[model samples]
Target: MKYDWILFDADETLFHFDAFRGMQVMFKRFGIDFTEKQYADYQLVNKPLWVDYQDGKISAEQLKVTRFQGWADKLNVTPKALNSAFLEAMADICTLLPGASELIEALTGQAKLGIITNGFTELQQIRLDRTGMSDYFEYVVISEEVGVAKPDGGIFAHAHQLMGNPCKSTVLMVGDNPHSDVLGGMNFGIDTCWLNTQAAQRPEGIAPSYEVSSLQQLQRILLA
Candidate 1:
């Protein structure tokens, strides 16, 4: 095999996390109105909590409770309601990204595939299973489970280890984020492919080995 393994990032790459839908449902059940502004605010707070949790500064459970608690405190809402609401929202809303299943199937058996992501392990698993993507990957490494997030290099190293330490030149890391996925892969000497759906330019001083606007573009690279 030219490429021994193919790694993917889950969030925006595999599926569109319907975060607003879940949040809305949770808020409605609690008789609370969730505004767009509030949703954005909470995400800002939650993102860092997750990063901290991934980096070993806090536990996964702590990250979840703290994000809800922090948002409830900021909005003067009951934390009890926030907890149940968050879970309810998470369960009700999960949308697979366009062509996600097709993409997975296309790469299946052509090269070993896996997911390297930073998110709740259970939630991500639910996504893969629900979307019928679990069968495509031999490995799925979540930062929360792996004790490190991307951009830190450790998580990338752990993921590589899980792939039996394939030669860096024979691995392809694909994801949406430049700072995390692309940078992490580059740091480990693996070729990185940036999935820039929005036409964003590569960050200065950090260039990916390949860049494509959509997952479909990968077809050409693999076939070549």
Candidate 2:
């Protein structure tokens, strides 16, 4: 492997983050059928909140509560309660992305593994535990706990310190989001691999060190 340490973004990179499915499961407890239309409507409010969160305009708590506000109003429940239910539902349905486990297992003895995710703290560990991936990582840096999200160098810096201040050249950051994962890693002076599963165009001025369509490809690249 070219790097001594490999940092991953948790959600879509390692785990399947089916938010719509999670919401449907969550709302069932309240006797509501979460339809596709409703999920589309939900994303209208949720997506921008995530952007604001990564931009440091809002805190993770604010993003969590605010995204559920409309549903809370409809259900006559507190937003905090709804958010908790959503996280619990997500954890219950959590599964590793295809090839994620194999890649991690293959890299176990080759490089130190860590996670630097902008995802919430409440769900990360539980999902890792459920999927039996808890022991693979040496560090799990959650933005919610770190007080800064990805795309900000602060979270990566925090991860670096936790990683015992390893040489920047010996680190690789891999993620599904170009802006948060690739650009952030580049800005922080580390190599990055963009997992462009959707075949999205690379944004101008934000080139990653490598790009691949699947975890299988990434694993090959790393172990080549």
Best by lDDT: 2
Evaluated at residue 214, the lDDT of candidate 2 is 98
For all candidates in order, the CA lDDT equals 0.79, 0.96
Cα lDDT of model 1 overall?
0.79
- Candidate 2 local distance difference test against the native: 0.96
Q: Mind giving the per-residue lDDT tens digits that candidate 1 earns over 1-224?
A: 46878899988888776777788888777677889998898888888876676456876667767778876786687665676566546756777767677777877888999899876675777777777777888998887777778867888888888788877899999999897889888888889989899998778977898898887887677757
Residue-wise C-alpha lDDT for candidate 2, range 1-224, written one tens digit per residue = 78999999999999999999999999999998889999999899999999999999999999989998988998899999999999999999999999999999999999999999999889999999999999999999999999999999999999999999999999999999999999999999999999999999999988899999999999999999
RMSD of each: 2.8, 0.7
Which 10-residue window of candidate 2 scores lowest in summed lDDT? Answer: 67-76
Worst lDDT 10-window in candidate 1? 79-88
Q: Show where candidate 1 strays beyond 4 Å.
A: 47-62, 72-88
| Candidate 2: regions farther than 4 A off | none
